[model samples]
Every structure is written in structure tokens, then in C-alpha cells.
Target: MTAKLADKYGPWGVVAGGSDGVGAAFAHRIAAAGINVVLVARRVPVLEACADEIRAEHGVDVRTVALDLSASDAVARLVDATADVEVGLFVYNAGADDISVPFLDKDVDTHLSLVRRNCGAVLEAAYRFGGPMVERERGGVVLVTSGAAWAGGASLAAYGATKAFDLVLAESLWAEWRGHNVDVLSLVLGMTDTPSLRRTLAAKGDAAPDGIATPDDVAETALRHLGDGPTWIHGAGDPTGPSPLGALPRRDAVLAMSRSWAEE
Candidate 1:
């Protein structure tokens, strides 16, 4: 993809959970387009390292903010940190759950924390950053979702639910902002070789190789299609068409998803 996206939504871009994996790849690609980037992550070292690499490689201005997106004050701190920068693109990519146990295996607070981070903070970012995009009559938002959102699985209760929330939020925003010249894309993903994914697979005792996407591929595909609003399913025959499992019965789809997630 060309760097025209940067010009269309220029000045700056923000990527939450941007220290590594898909988030870091996005930061690199956006910076390569000459757009200054603000990368937010929890670990200060990782965040700084990623920022420095973006500066060294892409040579675009980079800012690092160390904040836990799961925290209540995350979006507030992010807003304060980049208040002066014109953030034309916002990618909410921080929803990564490393444990996929049964619903009740985790406590209430743990589930609530994921919900707040995946849903609440995402909503706040859209409102705070997207508000300006609407005002300027340009900009973009990419909400990283998962195929887990397509169906309910045995070990994907909270995580899948939150992903579904992201998908719907992105699609709804796409609908609302299309006429306003703001692009919104719900980037649905499957298994990807991200650090977070490796940790999750290790936790589940499933280290066998499987068809997984690379973070660089995912980031490149998403950035190229940021204007392809509503959805951009990674590695799908029809990215904007119905779900791959849409033709199957609901029970069948759920059972298939359960088996696939369990085996993977």
C-alpha cells in the first residue's frame, strides 16, 4: 500500500498496545508514511524501544505513552498526553487475552477488567479522538477484532464477547462516519503469531504449529484497507461479504468454532 493514507489522514496516528506484535507493525507502517505516531503500551521499555525503532527506521516523530489500557484512567491519560497532536488515525489494538479458560475459571474482576479495556476504553478513544476527525471531515479508525466474534466458543466467553463488541462498534462507526469522510474499519483476525498469541497457546499447552498470520502481514493488510470500511477480514476470499461460517447452522457453527479453538 502506498503512503497516500497518511496524507488522507495526516498529522499523527495513535496505536494502543503498540509496543510489539501487530500494534508495533502498525506504528512502523504509519510512520513510514511520514505520519508522526503515538504508541501506547503498558511496559515503558517495550514502548520506548518500539518508538525508537520507528524513529530509526521510518524517521517519523514518535511518542511513547506507558499506560495500562485496562485501567480506568487510560483514555484520559492518553487524551492528556496527545492533546496537542492532531491524531488523524486511531487503531484500538490492545484487546489481547492470554488465558482462554472456562468462563467461571476466572474471577469476576478479571472478566470485568477485560470488558473495560476492550469496550469502555475503546469507546472513549473513539469519542475523544474520532470527534476531531469528524470535525475535520477526515481521519480513520481501525478496531482490531477476532474471528472469535463470529460465534460463541467454549473457552471464548469474555474474549469473544468483547471482540464482538469491537466488531459492532467499528461497523456502526463506519456507517455513521462514511458520509462524513471518516473511514472506520473492523479488522477481523484469526490465529496470528503474535507474542500474546504465543503466550496464550503456551498457557493452553498447545504448541503445535498451525496456520497463523504474521503481525507484519496483518498490519500491512489493515492499513492498506483502512478505507474499506465495515470490515476487512484478514485472509478471507470475500473480506466484505458474509461470515465464512454464515451458511452453517448456528449450532453447527458454534460446535465447529469450539472444536477449532480447542484444538488450536
Candidate 2:
């Protein structure tokens, strides 16, 4: 994306999962645009490290907030915590994976917890902070949903559902906030190279294959789309190629493909 374009869209950005990987890269790019950033994450040390880099390189004010967003009270805390700052960009990127087990083998608690973290927290953040952005009559909201959101993946049943919820919710918000200048975006990401992905592979005792996307790649693509101001961006396949399979209804197709990953 063009530097001028980034500057045009950003001056203050908040990243909910800004401590590492894709989220951290978003922070960096925004900071490079001379935007002050507010980093939110569960680990203080991680947030401090990310903040330090942005501060040193971009000379942007970095504020770190340590909070576990999986907690039911997290959204309220986040709003209260950042209430004083005027953020022009909001990225709802925090997420929890579905239980990596057979449907019958998964625990109910884990499923509910994932829903609360992935769907509920994202909704709360978007609405609470997003309302103010609309009132301000200028701002952007980017939601990090998964490619799986476009369909039902039985292996990731809970996660897929929550991501679907995130995508649809953002789209609705876009329509609602269209005339208000609050640009709402929903990013559908494929498998990205992150610590979480590595950990998942290790836990499943699987070898690294090919075609996994890096955090930097994901960040760059997302920023490009955000700068382009597209309502929805797909991660895998060419950006202009095939018109995004997710754009079509493929619930059964996704569930079939998910079964292959389940055994892995």
C-alpha cells in the first residue's frame, strides 16, 4: 500500500491482539505512518516489546494494555481503558481456536469459551468503541475473520461459527455506518505463519509443509486491502483471482475439506 494512502487513513490505530505476529505487523505499519498506537494483549512483557520497537523505529506514542480478552468483562475494561484516546482505526483481531478434537470429543465449556472470546468480544469492541468513531464521523474498523468463516468446518465447528458471526456482523455494521464515514472491513485470512499455527502443528505432531503465509505477508496484504478500502479481503489465492470462493455459499464444501485437516 502507498505510504500516502496509509497516512490518509490512519493517525491513531488500536490493535486488540497487537503483541505479536500479524497484529504486531499492523501496529508497525500504522506506526510507520506516524500514527500513535494503542496495543492490547494479555501479556505485559509482550506488549512492552512490541511497543518498544514501534517507539524506537517510528517515534509514535505506544500505550500497552494487559488484559485477557477472553474474560467476559474484557470489552468494558477495554473501552474504559482507552476511553481517553481518540483512535481513528480499530482492528478486532483477537481470537481463540476451536477445540482440536472430534465433535463428540470436545468439551462444552471449551466451545462456549471460544465463542465468548471470538464472537462476543469482537462484537463488544466494535460496538462500544465503534459507536464513538461513528459519532466522530471518521474512523475505520477492521475485523480479522477466518476463511473458514465463509463455510462450516466441522473440525473447527465452533471457531468457524464465531468467525462467520464476526464477518456478517462487520458487514452489517458497514451498511449501518456507511453514510457516517466509519469504514468497516472484514478480513478473511487463510493459514498464516504465527506462533499459534506452529504450536498447533506441533501439538498435532505434524510436519511443516508448504504454502503457509507469514505474518508479514498477511499484514501487508491486509493493509493493502484496507488502503484500497475494499469491504472484504480474502487472504489465500490471488487477490484478483477466482473471485474468492468464500463469496459463494459452500457450507458443505468447507465441512468436507475440514475433515482432511481434522485427522492431521
Candidate 3:
């Protein structure tokens, strides 16, 4: 499987937000599969630590880029950083809102920054990294989204919107690139036990609920089903099935989501 992955989407892989949690999991798995990895994240210390671990454990080259994806030139900088290598896999996994307050409670700039990071940067990464993959006729792209994207919720306004955008973008790209041998997957996650989620829950003086997915499990599942594109819902009974809220009326779905947030 490792050899197959390397031969098909090998040489190098880029994981934005590849410091800890799901991003780091992806980096480790990719490296273990014999692919050199370029790990991009905001914290220099955490990024370096993760890179070093991958290098030691997997015996594969690992590069670290301490970059904030919200920056306007992030994708351009990433392209320049990896200009010498052929990145056959690109995973944008950085969008996670640490706050879960109502829309009006958060400042305008904060929401805008989230939009920049989650939506704009993701789109740009897909364009820049995915284009090269299409040109070469072999590569995979995974856009890590959230189940919040299924409907609008009380405290997930900006976050949900951005993830919805990612979901659509990945599915659309899959439609256009499947014939070109470029796989695109929108990995929709539910509650995951990541540092980001922990912080969010901590801020509310709460702990993670039972049965939340783990980063390593999520990463492994996504990588194994790279070609089962369009969409993949982690932890769902039917991974490739319709949304859990598919049969609900739109208004009821929104209300249901809002109630969940209120309970949280």
C-alpha cells in the first residue's frame, strides 16, 4: 500500500496546518508511506517538533514552513517554498474556530480572518497545488471540512459558511478532475478530539463528549479512501452516503443545528 501510494502520489506531500492533531497525523502517515512531506503551520516550535518526529520515525524527508494560512500571500509563499519538489498530495487542514460564540458576539475582523483562512486560502491552495497535479496526471487533494457545513447553526456562522464552501469546492474539483487522474476529497468531520476542539470546549468550561473521533483515525480513514472522492463523512455508518440531515426540511435542519449549539 505504501509503495502504491508513493508511486501514484509520491515524491512529496504538503499538509497545511501540519503541526499537531489531524495535520500531524496526515504528515506521519504520508511519511510512513515513503513520501517526503512539507509541513506547514503557524507555530514554529510545534511545526519543527512535528517535522523532526516524522523524520525520525518514518525515515523520510520532512520540511517545516511556519506560516499563517490567513495571510493573503500564503499559497504563493507555499508554492515558492516547495518549488524544487513535486507535491503529489496536498491537504488543507488548518481551518478550526476556537471560539463558538454567536455571530454578533465575535468581532468583525475575527470573522473576516476566519473567512480568509478557511475559504480564500483553501481555494488558493487547491488552485496552485492542484493545477500541478492535474498537469502531471496524478495527485490527490483533501479539504478537511466540518459537519457544521451541513446546515447553519447558532454559533457556527462563519465557520459553517467557510466549510460549506470547501465542501462544494472539493466536490466540484472532483467532478472536473476525476477523468484527469486527480483525486479530490472533501473529508467532512464531526466532533474530533483535536487540540483545537479541546480549546474550544475548554473555553466553555466543558470537556469533550464521548465517542468523538481521534486525529489519527480520521487521517488514516481519509488517506485510505482518497479516490472515493466528492465527499467522505468520518465516523458515519455510511461514509459515502448522504448527509445525516438529508431528509429534514431545510428550516428544521437549521433549527436542529441551532438547538444543538444551544445545548452545547
The C-alpha RMSD of each candidate to the native structure, in angstroms, is 1.2, 2.6, 0.8
Cα lDDT tens digits, model 2, 1-264, are: 546534445667889999887899888878887778889998888889989989999898898888888889988987787788787889888774723665668888888888888888998999887888889888878898877675676677788788889888887888888788787887777777776667777777765568777777777667766633434555544653442444645765675658656655
| lDDT per residue (tens digit) for residues 1-264 in model 1 | 546977799889999989999999998888988999999999898889889889999888999899989899999999999999899999999998978889999999999999999999999999999999999999999999999999898989999999999999999999999999999999999878888888877876767376778889999989988888799999898888889888999999999989998876
- Which of the two candidates, 1 or 2, achieves a greater lDDT against the reference? 1
Full-model lDDT for every candidate: 0.91, 0.77, 0.94
Query: Top model by lDDT, which number?
Result: 3
lDDT: worst 10-residue window of model 1:
203-212
What's the TM for model 1? 0.97
- Candidate 3: worst-modelled 10 consecutive residues by lDDT: 1-10
Instruction: Point out where model 1 deviates above 4 Å.
Output: 208-211
Candidate whose TM-score is highest: 3
Q: What lDDT does model 1 reach?
A: 0.91
- Predicted structure 2: lDDT: 0.77
Clashes of 3: 0
